[model samples]
Target: MNPEKAFKYDVLINAEDLCDREFEQQDFLKRAKAKKRTIVFAPRRYGKTSLIKNVVGNSFFNLSRNHLVLFFDLMDVQSMESIAKRLHHGITQALSRRFPVKTLLKNATDYLKGFSLQMDMDPVTGQPSLSMNVKGREVENEMTHLMAAIKTLSQKYPTLIILDEFHDITFVPEAEALFRGVLQELGESAVFILGSKRHLLTLMFQDARAPLFQYGDEIHLNPIALEDWLDYFRERMTPNKIIIGEEELKWILETLCDVPNAICEFGAWLLDNIPSGMTLSVGVIKQSLDLMVENKQSYAYMLQGYTEKELDLMTVIAKNKFTLEPHAESFLKLIRVSKSTVGKIVKKFMDRGLIEYELEKGYRLSDPLMGHYLATR
Candidate 1:
């Protein structure tokens, strides 16, 4: 097998595996190690998860010996039970990493008061893991107990917990309140690192009445710049004897809106297609992009649910490529919709997660490629 095949240009879960975002990594490291609460948010696919993991991993190495790091991914959690299970899993994972299995097993009950812990060994790896259950019967009871457990654990050890895709908690009323209350109760001893999709995340922190309002310092993750992409690609391609020119690299970045995931995926595609000892060119880039669009028929399928006005507005959005004033006379005229109709359409788009609007930034489509699909298809 070719060793280069192991290289990934996909979703990165660890910081050590990523090539850029040095600024974000350092900022998070400093704040988190200081035990300051921080919230790291970005649009989907902007590599927020990888950044947090990198910072968390670094903290374990650099922070005071008494501190423990815990990561809970709330992406797949839907109900109180599931969230409890994930928290249980996260706490166990952190404990397993820090203390011996025998020690954790002996002390788990004392460390986590409200929840019961059962220790077992992995048959293959022979590593000990724990399962948690509340002393009570219902999920709410379990969650209440879990919160108690977290409170107890936080007081005992200085802990940092990263809640990835935390915005999903909005779906469950009880879970959101319980989690927030716990964080409030725990105070400075437990620092939370939250990750979420930008739209929902915005609502959580920006809405004054929300439980997570003013929860922590908000750090927005933006696109990795062109020069960073160039440096990264040049280094990755060097081992394969392939080189991409400055202009060629710029075109790719421009085409992909400088999104790191797209840039990495497109670069990998180029590596697979370009012959060794050859310089990649504009034509090759266009051809690869065309192939990618052709394969993404699902983008078209996604538009099937939108009204004609919504689709027209999307096309205009793609063409303008900036925050849009959909209510403006020119935009309404171009889309041929009335002012009242435009407001409804914008809200509809926002509700469906296809678009977003802010006073400062106007309106934006969530995915850049989705705009490309609308403009061309």
Candidate 2:
């Protein structure tokens, strides 16, 4: 091995085989098979995207005469027309991987017909240029051609449409209702797997007046256990190729709060440093941690709806080892609010989905994954 170096490429850590999350995977797969449109809810960086990626790779469902999985991410998309265009493009990408678009979209209407409901992107500065205008107004009729296309395609291939950041679709105003309506009409013919961060989805469903209300099976993605992670790392480490000491491993896990993205960041950092056959150390880890923290401080400012007192309380919870629940003394002092007052604040936050609580105890941030930020600044 080379005598000395600053490590190699960067640490690259990931589940050995996509870590198929049991409850989530089984729930959605079953729903999809029953032709039930489903929504997967999870906060950012909690592995929603990763889970979808894993499902696609698993082939647990058949593509021939059963299910054809089509995945799309709306992270960069922004408008109504953009929705139709993006779905057209996403489905086309999935189908055309083997079939040609020219062959499938034989008619002008056929071009716009494949998209039942679309997640819009701003016409300008979109990730990919999509032409989605078909015929009719914003009403259900407007989606006829696109709906027809998806129905036709499913007859032959049985599409499993996986939409990422589906909650964002609501920002397009009228898009959510139309999409949900389409789901109702599709029935057992096709399946849609939609995922979003939080509140928006619940709000849509809670409001019985909305078309999307109680539309599909709601599945929550969960964090992987520490024990599973430890076992995984042990299997992947080979003394001659890469070495990860127990202390360094523990430090990495503790600092990141088991966040998938943070774990990935540590892995990437680790990969960049590992020499052909050398072990990692504390210094390498500290440097990488600083880099990640430095890059992430901006989000702290972005999460600015809270008051100073609230922020301080959040900090306390962030640093504390106590449970996230109600009537907890430590949490009360951390927020510096009286019992009832803290209850009000907690209720407000719960309504906004900024935090969550156990029915019997106290509250914590709505998303546990955001706990990663506490590790930083």
Candidate 3:
């Protein structure tokens, strides 16, 4: 954690916890009361989970009478039932553990037990588990049962389900149907705050023909304000506050595009390496950037979901360090992609928010890390 960094590992520092999150408090209250669903889409390492955790931590919402926030991050979960039951149990468990749910959800525990619900945790860690039939029809039934269970809880208590790494649902169409159904059925009584790496949900809804075709307030979690990042770093400085040259730090942020996670990771490296930790010079910052660049594969993994040509296009954009939105035509020549296929790939990535296109500006990486990875990978 290095304690004194703009941000740190395992820390949830978002707008909600900044002494006053009142600016967005109204929207939070409305979402809580209206019970709408939000799909949060951002590039990798953007603190999607941290922001939601912060939202739940904010006393204005989490402690309110009409709200129960359940956050489930299925980053590593590969199966569906494990997701189902964990979601099922997480809602009720969070209700009981985090809040005064006895009054909000009567019977509290027994009412849930009465549902005849059954679930188990992953064998290794004993954390709640979920799995689905690989090639059968069981997923539909599981989804049905899972939704039925979540809805049952909503009947008793106002519930806000925050699903992180939500794009994982794309792996199973059955899961998508189940989620779409949840959005359809839960309506204004329940709030869904979802987080995903890409804008898959946007495309799913944006395409009028898709079943899950509707969307409500779509919030893009931006980089943690740079000032906040620096202030936190100044406070967290350990041993002795390590003074990083402003220009060097600015260069790092400019290179990284002010991403909180990367800032924390880079800061950690610098903090641990400094001999006296009194002050950091431009060379020290450059050294950290070198390490981050050398090990670019770590960040590049996030884009592994994209195809090879897609990677090629990204590589060009990364090398050039262009913006997210650019015309498809320019990319065709740069990546040496075939004219026929370039249009399709560009359209596909653009629609997915993987890249953006501006009339005058040409195309580029959606974020700095993605850009850098494309350049190096």
**RMSD to truth, every model:** 3.5, 6.8, 5.7
User: Candidate 1 — what's its lDDT?
Assistant: 0.72
Give the candidate number with the greatest lDDT.
1
The candidate that wins on TM-score is 1
Order of quality (lDDT): 1, 3, 2
Write candidate 2's Cα lDDT for 1-377 as tens digits: 63332211123222334443666666666666666666777655566655554553234335453355666666535676677666666655555443433543453344345233323443675533224444566634545565566656555556666777776676687777666766666764534454443556677765688666777767666667766665555455553367767787777766655455656555656565557576768787777666655566555775686787666656666555225564578667656688887667665665454564432334445443355465346
Candidate 1 TM-score over all chains jointly: 0.84
Instruction: Give candidate 2 misplaced runs (Cα > 4 Å).
Output: 1-17, 20-34, 57-62, 65-67, 75-78, 105-144, 190-192, 206-213, 235-251, 273-292, 295-317, 320-376
Residue 150 miss distance in model 3 (angstroms): 0.9
lDDT (CA) for every model shown? Answer: 0.72, 0.57, 0.59
Worst 10 residues of 3 by lDDT: 128-137
Q: How would you encode candidate 3's per-residue C-alpha lDDT over 1-377 as one tens digit per residue?
A: 54322435547666633422344445655666666666656555566665555654344345556555665665535678667656755664665454442352444344344233324555897655332222224755655655665676566666676777666667654677667777677764645455543445555655788886666666665555556556556565544557755576677777766556666767666666666546766776666666666675665567668778877766776676654433456656677778767768876775555665332344555555556655654
* lDDT by residue for model 1 (1-377), tens: 53543236555656545667787777777776677778876655667766776555556545666677777888856787789888878877777777776787788888677677777877988877777766778877777777777777777887776788787776766777777788788675536555535667777887898767887888777767767777778877988888888899899867766556767777777777778998788997787777776678788888888778778988888766565577888877788888998788776666555675433655666666776666666
Candidate 2 residue-wise lDDT at 358: 32
lDDT comparison, 1 vs 3, better candidate: 1
Error of 1 at 150 (Å): 1.6
lDDT measured at residue 22 in model 1 versus the true structure, 0 to 100:
81
Residue-pair clashes per candidate, as listed? 0, 29, 15
Q: Which candidate, 1 or 3, has the higher TM-score?
A: 1
